[model samples]
Target: MKYDPIDSNLFKKNRKKFMAQMKPSSLAVFNSNDVFKTGADSTMPFKQHRDIFYLSGADQEDTVLVLFPDCPDPAHREVLFVTETNDHIAVWEGEKLTKEKATEVTGIETVYWLKDLDKKFFEMMTQCDTVYFNTNEHYRQAVEMETREDRFIKKTKAQYPAHNYAKSAPILQRLRAVKEPEELELLQKACDITNHSFRRVLDFVKPGVWEYEIEAEYLHEFIRRRSDGFAYTPIIASGNNANVLHYIENNQQCKDGDLILMDVGAVYANYSADMSRTIPVNGRFTDRQKQVYNAVNKVKNEATAMLVPGTLWKEYHVEVGKLMTSELLDLGLLDKADVQNENPDWPAYKKYFMHGTSHHIGLDTHDYGLLWEPMQANNVFTVEPGIYIPQEGFGIRLEDDVVIQESGAPKNLMGDIPIEVEEIEDLMNK
Candidate 1:
């Protein structure tokens, strides 16, 4: 891991919170993500499943965590199974966590090798009537690939069909939504790294620079600052490309007068920071660009202020849409008729500002949070509002990651990053 070690107490607290919600006589299991294959001899990078990482602080593959708070034996209450390391394996793959190291990292004193998992798990299963399985239930999830967790759940069911099975997704969704103090610190670090990268881009971007070049600049700064690369696939959209919400090809050359909408972030210690900023290709924004940019910035500020406790996710978006409607009207993109005749399903503001203004941002870019529930303090979210004007040959978006507070306005994680039209122009020209 490039980042510094996280305190194991955080993981200890997370496990305690999760186990508190588990049914009596129940055991919960979590598996690390698979190292997916690219082809015959190549494989994609390993990313630990966020759920397991959240509870164990074990950022390695082929690891498993079991929690049985009701176990008769105290040693079996919380156990961690890790792949054993040997001389040959260590030479080939570097240092893997040993038993003592695993305990230090996860705060679970009972550690066993992966080879003994089946024997130990079977013994525990006999004592518990119910089992909790971690499943992906994020609202934006569209996973088709069978994961390590999937195979474990399938085999467990086949082996112990009589056991009462329960979903761990709901419990995790609620718990992971609210950031712990340690998590908030990591998120702030990620955002601070992103700020450095964005400032670098401001100095590097020129009229004729290719979008990929800007992407490379961001990557260079991220790695140098100890980040684990981007939080998500970056959107380095230039010109009308910004109109395509997920545009990541990054192959176009930025024209002199066009705006480049960059939806990018840095990840530190598995915590994610999401930020979106649109700036002119040239040193300064055109008058019209400034108008639209300020409008989007205003909407972002107001939308962030609405992220206080007790705000419903859906209702918050509805309110943000009204704010965008007013901005679009002032921009002359929507007239009185456009507002009056707008379809209730897709409002008039959809013509320009189509996407939602905010979403939970943390471990995963679109982190777990129940949409129906009211917002709470410590819930981190991205306040992004944009106006994509294809007809004008450019688009503008300004976003910031914010933490909902117990009182007053939410704290903007990306607050120090340049966003104002003049500030951006000054930095670019400097």
Candidate 2:
């Protein structure tokens, strides 16, 4: 919990939106993420489930949120179940949230101990006809490990087989896709922190510096600014390592006249900002590198324009592909024959630019948005386009976080951050 406390109104509004979508007499439950084990006694740092955090603003582990708007008892309408913190437990694990503070953080009037959940939840389950179960239904999700929410679904089904079960994922998917004004404020803060880190790295990076050192510079800035950390695993690949896509090793030394592809961001109040930028270690891109860099930047700018409202997610990428193809042609990386002979599934542009151009981004890096649906306002996305040339020992990518607007183009969250080749070089040399 390195970040500052979020405004409870955001959570309150989120809960209101969720409840409005629920069918009459239906109750919903959201579970915090489990603290994963690294080894026997070693456990990975606790990360709150984004959904619970979204609804309740409760960042603590082992917490549960119950929404029973139609409960017979008025006090049971909205409740938070937090682990009870006693004197002995406080001494062992530091201080956890107390009942008073839990109410303050969540704006939930009723708070109960985790020990009282089963008895109370059973009482509500019998009163309600349907239960809204939280499940991960993001398109990119390939969850192999059974999550806390999964176990809850299984156990609840067995416990109340007669009660109708409903999916909360669909409601959440649509709701979380649209950002509230308060959510945007937190996301902007994350982007501003990332901007500071990127500027610091620009000055710190030079020939002979290890790639991991640059990664350290980014994390140091993020931590000092009170960001939880990188939104996802950072990619600090230097020179040809940038072509490898998911290069987290960051062990290679940066050389003069080479580009470093940093796909990094910061998380503030659990909201994510994703950015990717390629910069020359020597603070000046060579003639050939400048050509490739501008091409990618051009592609990025054009791709971002496609994120406006009412655009299909798949259609936007296809249009972006055409944009990239034109840039690749001008860069002499692809010719007319290469474009003509390319397979429909794997286009000619995939040779230099393999991965996707944009993805929904917010709570998670690859966040919740139905890919099959048309783009809408308040939907945040990242525009990342890269041209990787392994043979030339360099890769170029330029990215910015953007929000889909009601009309015109999406607003670029990272627009203030330096991106032009001249601007980056001048900032680094300064």
Candidate 3:
């Protein structure tokens, strides 16, 4: 891991909170993510499962966590099963966590090799009537590939069909939504790294530069600062390409009058920071570009202010749509007739600012939070608003990560990053 070690107390607290929510006499299991294959003899990078990482602070593959708070055997109450490391394995791969190292990292005193898992798990299963399965239930999830968790669920059900099963997603969704103090610190670090990368890009961007070059600059800056590259696949959209909400080809040359929409971020210690900024390729926005940019920035600011405790996620987006509508009317994109005739389901503002203004942001770029529930303090989110004007040959979007606070306004994680029109122009020219 390029990032520094995190305090294990956070994980300990997370596990305690999760266990408190579990049904008595029930055991929960979490598995690390699989190292997916690219092709023959090649594999994609391993990413730890967020749930396990949140509870155990274990960031390695082929690891499992078993939690049984009411277990008769105290040692089996919280057990960590890790892949055993040998001389040949250590030589081929870097140092794998040993039993002592695992205990230090996870705060779980009982550690067993992977081979002992079946025997130990069988013994525990006999003691518990219910089992908790960690399933992906994020609202935005569209997973088709079977994960390691999926394999575990299949094998467990086949082995013990008579045992009662429950979903762990609901508990995790609620718990992970609210940030612990330590998690907030890691998120701030990620945003700081992202700010550094964005500032570097401001100086590096110019007319005739390829979009990919700008992407490379961000990667260089993020990696140098101990980040785990981008939190998501970056969108380095230039010119009208920004109209495509998910543009990531990054093959276009930025023309003199083009506006580049960079939807990028940096990840530190598995925490994500999401930001979006549109800047002129030639170091100055045209009058019309400035108008659109300012409009988006205004929407972003107004939307961010609405992210307070007790706000409903669904109602919050509707309110943001109204804010965008006012901006669109001011921009002459929508007139009185357009507003009167527009459907309430798809408002007049959908013509320009089509996407949702905010979403919970954290471990995953689109982090987990129940949309039906009211927003709460310490929940972090991204405030992004945009206007995609294909007819004008440019698009503008502004985004920042924010933490909902108990009073006043949500705290901006990307507050130090340049956002004002003059600030961006001055930095680009310098």
TM-score on alpha carbons, each prediction? 0.99, 0.98, 0.99
Candidate 1, lDDT over the whole model? 0.94
Cα lDDT of model 2 by residue, 186-266, tens digit: 899999999999989988988999998998999999999999889999999888999999999989999988889999999
**In candidate 3, what are the lDDT values of residues 309-378, reduced to their tens digit?**
9999899999999889899999999999999999988998998988888898888899989889999999
Model 1 per-residue lDDT tens digits across residues 140-247: 999999999999999999999999999999999999999999999999999999999999999999989999999999999999999989999999999999999999
By lDDT, is 1 or 2 better? 1
lDDT at position 53, candidate 3: 98
Show where candidate 2 strays beyond 4 Å. none
Score residue 62 of candidate 1 by CA lDDT: 98
